[model samples]
Target: MQPIVHPVVGYVCYAVYARWADGTPPASSPAAVAVVAATLPDLLDQPLYHAGITPVGRTIGHSLLFAVPLVALVWLVARRRGQSRLAVAFAIGYGSHIAADVPWHVLAGDYHELGFLLWPVTPMPAYSGVKTLGTVGGLEVTTLWLEAVIFVGGVALWWADGRPGLDLLGRRFDL
Candidate 1:
């Protein structure tokens, strides 16, 4: 998945989850946390891989081994801090990211692409050639179209949900 898609998907998931669980959209803080969590894996793995520090783009950060424990720790800390919702949002975002990367490959019997999910226990495949941006001029027309649809839907949902996190930016910038 592209980095742009991840956070949009995360926000949509959080909105859906909140509407189901709390009968409303997520609040600013949890929404923000979820968006950040969605990108956490790439943030951690991409730099290292591009710099030749790791063999693949989805090593430790994409591993369930790392995510499960980290989320558990986040849950524990958030519970203590009286912010369990934040932890849940984080889990949803992080889990969505991992889920987005794996299921299609698994269904297609491309288990080799999923080696990163186990990390050290299952060595990641070596870095393949760089992936293109999936833009209109790029080769991945289907991916570009899918991402565009998802992004448009996500923005629509966010707007309908009152743009929950917009206030955070306004407050931060004194707008």
Candidate 2:
């Protein structure tokens, strides 16, 4: 998927994470901090992809092994803060990150292999081939639409969660 779409998806997952936290701590809370941290690994791709210095699959950020350890570390930190919720929030975000990417991976294989979805648990790397999201037409249409659906669905679910104010992106400040 495009880097532009990736962040949007991350924000969608952020909304999910925030909803799971029920606004008691806010998205800026320790819980949200872990969620944001989980998204950090993807930020690396922005520079690498734009610079054209790195192949898509060459980055370790795409590795589940790399991410799980980082997630655990953040979870541990949140635990120390007496906030297990934060750790769980991070896990949700991280899982969302992977879940959001699956469609794209299914459509098009990364520059190299598919990616380390199974990672340390299983070394079997899958191949998406070049037919799925590889073509410009497919990616533009499918990814954008998928992002829209996830974004809307996440917001709706958050609303359904019965939280009072819409704290998304600090929008509460507008009121």
lDDT of each: 0.84, 0.54
User: How far does residue 61 in candidate 1 sit from its true spot (Å)?
Assistant: 0.9
Per-residue CA lDDT of candidate 1, range 1-175, in tens? 6778888899999988999998988899999888899999999999999999988789988999999999999999999999999999999999888887764455445678788889989988863422333356545544446667988999898888888888998999999
After superposition on all C-alphas, the RMSD of every candidate to the true structure, in Å, is 3.7, 6.3
User: What does candidate 2's lDDT look like per residue over 1-175, in tens digits?
Assistant: 4433443454455555555657542344533444465466567544764587654432556567777787789789989989886677666666666665566655554433444564434343443432333346444454556656765674555455443223544674764
Best by TM-score: 1
At residue 115, candidate 2 shows an lDDT of: 49
Clashing pairs in 1: none
TM-score of each: 0.86, 0.58
lDDT of 2 at 31: 34
